[model samples]
Target: MNKSIVFLMVILWLAQGLYAQTYRKDLPDIAISKDVSLHFISPEPIQYVDISTHAIAGDLPLKNVLRLKIVPDSVTHFALTGSVAGIVTVVGESFIAQYNLRYTEGQAFTVPSQVNILPEHTRPLDVPGIALTSKEMQDFAMRILQQPAESTLRKAKAFGIQAKLNHVYTAGDHIFLDITYYNKSNLSYQIDEQRFKIEDKKITKATNVQSVEITPVWQLYPNTAFKKQYRNIYVLKKATFPGNKVLNIELTEKQISGRVLTLKLKYDDLLKADAF
Candidate 1:
């Protein structure tokens, strides 16, 4: 099947929260400089945006494919890389468009007041943080769903942790808990600085659980549907579930006052690994 056809099917699945996007096929093709510094400006606020060029045929250099960065300098103007180039398409929750451009060694280019965030019935929500948008989120969510469901250790939703748990395992005396934190409400939390803690609900200053460590499995930003759910793996030390089958976990936002999430985990809901 044609790549465009395949992408269209995926696009349809995402049309619900996305705007109809198209490229300015008629726009004059731009030639990029050797340094690959391309720039453009958007008139309206881009709630989320991503830009990429499709390979026409054979393999392209890894740098060309990976160096493409859409860095928003401010609310409207942003920078693009010209070092590697091809036909670039820009898409967002409320906007969709493309720019036909070529990256030629030693040639630099700047967009001349081009590109528009085509009007849409549903306006994009101006959420704080990265402008990666929802397209990337949907792409990631699909990837997560493609994983084997049996690999999921425990799935639960509460305290800003959305939908499902990613994975869980135990090695020696430590317990590893894979979790994804998401923001579905108008309220937003700084994911990068988020923290976690595990304690016994029944006992005050209990000595049962030793230590808990958190490792970010993925970097999270705002606006993208799946991106909102930042993935993390908690390395718990000497953690043991009591006979009563209850676990208490807390999520905290240092910047916000009274912004803490308490998760009540039941033993029966937890899928134990073979080691346990």
Candidate 2:
């Protein structure tokens, strides 16, 4: 063989070997079957999952665990035809994982423990710190509920119903708003809707007022009716608005007695939020 040709062949072989090594470092293949479930356990709660094909079904039985199984119909087809391969992606709070899926005939496989899958990239830290899981945030909110009221000046009343913003707490990347409702009337208060929004501090007939709605990450109370008094905690992502904007917590009542109450908070109120 010519010297130049021999050198070219040697270079090609080396390149192929390097490619194989890189592929070997990829995530382990997950074996799935129709009769058994394959579980992927992570350190953090899984936020999202993507399956390449419909032949595989996936679910989160727990916040940090993902279960995957091959569809029964697909299993029969695979048995008659051949094995099918696809990709599975799992996204967590701090990391992203990708796995090669292999469909086979026997029992499915489960991870013995939490597996440290390679992350595609590191996620940047949010303002204060990493956000807590839903359960953790709920537990913290319950503790806040037990604390004494911190503010009495932020209040609104109408039709013998009073709405007050009692306390504001901050933890991790979230803000907790403690509020209470007092019904002084003999009749019960049936809540029709509760809205949180940021709107212009002042509005005029000629000016176009713009309002932005804010959704709570979680709430401690789900009840809508109260005879005497009720206290609730709402969790929201930590955010800041311009000084000209105000945060409005509005509550409306159902039919017949259509009463409404709103508690407004200025930017300073959010600045006063105590650390949890």
Candidate 3:
């Protein structure tokens, strides 16, 4: 035997072994039935789901937030004959999962009542984005809370309630605003609406005022009622506006009392935000 031929054969054998290990045939099977449905729960929100065959169907009942529901397709005539198997792939925000789906006549004791996607069975997804997750945002907010309030922006007081902007911080592509509300009176403040908008600083009677609403991407410490004082951190995407416009933070109380507190943040105030 030639030395080169032996070396070539050894390389081919190693390559084949590596390929076999990568695509193992011993995937765990999930039993599916027309009458019985299978539910899968993921650690994070699901991004995509792919069913390899027409014998089974899958859908995100909660709009792909976290749960995936699977059922056997009745219209697939081939499923009625005998056993039908397919592959199911579920992609989540941080992980990917694959499973072998098998159609069965009826639900059996071996059938899993619910499938919880385990971290060990999933591979990490390399999603490209600078956006922070909710948990990360919340953790950042906690760090901001530890800093002393240094902002002296506009404040509002109404119906024995005082609201003010405490601090502003900038990081990457997002801005964090720390706000505090104090109830001077003993009555509890029940917040009905919390809104942010950019509007003209000065409005004339003859001129129609234009306002654009800004929605916060994340909020820390979400609560509706507070007695003495309430503090929260709101996260918003970084944006730019003209000097003539001001960011308005409005908090309206629930019905009956219907009191409103409004705070204004000028464009200059946003520019003064300290980097975290």
Candidate 4:
């Protein structure tokens, strides 16, 4: 009954508030340098692209896959910027999906971290569940279908923010990124293991990249028994000077390893007209 009240309040809060989101980049609790430092923020995984791996992924370097290779048409940051579900109008430590409206830069650009709040505007009470991992999908689905009076709720540990830059690069371009996160451990949390294309920075583009699925990594099958269950949000970050002529590019998660993955530009370059 207590849980129902809390969940109900959350539902009413979201359903009643209908404020439109503003454009901005989401930064971390601490400040960072944009040049050589990459902060691994915890961003909600795009579940539609979630993949799973069969066999255990052996020792692999994360840098090989998470590097940025192309410039994006729009840079968005999913972070904390809204109101607490059951709290007052003032948004102090609320989570938000920050979409930064920008294009690629010939030179590196730095976005400052500011604790900006979305102005208190009339918001619909029916916003979707806060972005989370696939396993958390059940909760999201529940929030959408079940009424607050009947909802079963599980609280989350912390909210996270991540930046996605859409870009296309050409051949012969090189990238080097140095990424940093809250703490190496806090930032390494990941899910969906099929997206990693493991290799060195020296090799620019290779078509034959191995991929996997989400079911295998989560071990969600009823037949299989497991001791621990994990819920993670991985932040795939690009340091400085990603690779060349890369297009239609985005970060993905591998099935078995829970690492960040990216597609190479050897095959195609995304034009401004074709970008999402």
The sequence of per-residue lDDT tens digits that candidate 2 reaches over residues 1-276 is: 999999988876664443221122366665566677677876667878997767778899987888877776665444433444467788776567777666666633442323445444234333233467656777888898788876674898988999888888888778888999999999999999899999999988998989999998788888589999989999888778999999999998898898898889998998888897
TM-score of each: 0.32, 0.60, 0.67, 0.17
Specify the poorest-scoring 10-residue window by lDDT in model 4. Answer: 49-58
**lDDT of each structure?**
0.43, 0.76, 0.75, 0.26
| Candidate 4 stretches greater than 4 Å from native | 1-34, 47-96, 99-217, 220-276
For candidate 4, lDDT tens digit of each residue in 1-276? 699999987865664443223332342122222222222222222211111111101121231111111112112111122221111121111232222222222233453322233323212222243322333433423332232222211121222313222222111121211111111233443434223232333433565433322122221222211123321222222122234322222233334543443433322122221211
Sorted on lDDT, best first, the list reads 2, 3, 1, 4
lDDT of 1 by residue, 6-93 (tens): 9987866564223222335564465544344354343333333344432222221221121233222211111233223445544333
Model 2 local distance difference test score: 0.76
Off by over 4 Å in 3: 1-39, 52-85, 101-130, 146-154, 221-223
Best by TM-score: 3
Worst 10 residues of 1 by lDDT: 70-79
Judged by whole-model lDDT over C-alpha atoms, candidate 1 comes out at: 0.43
After the best TM-score superposition of candidate 4, give how far the Cα of residue 210 lies from its true spot, in angstroms: 28
> For residues 1-276, what per-residue lDDT tens digits would candidate 3 score against the true structure?
999999988976664443221222666667666565678877666778876654456668763333323433443443333444556788876678888766666655656657888877788777666366555687889998897766656578888998878888887789999898989998888989899999999989997999999999888877599999898999999989999999989999898888888888998888988886
Candidate 1 versus truth, CA RMSD in Å, comes to: 19.2
Steric overlap count per candidate: 6, 0, 0, 42
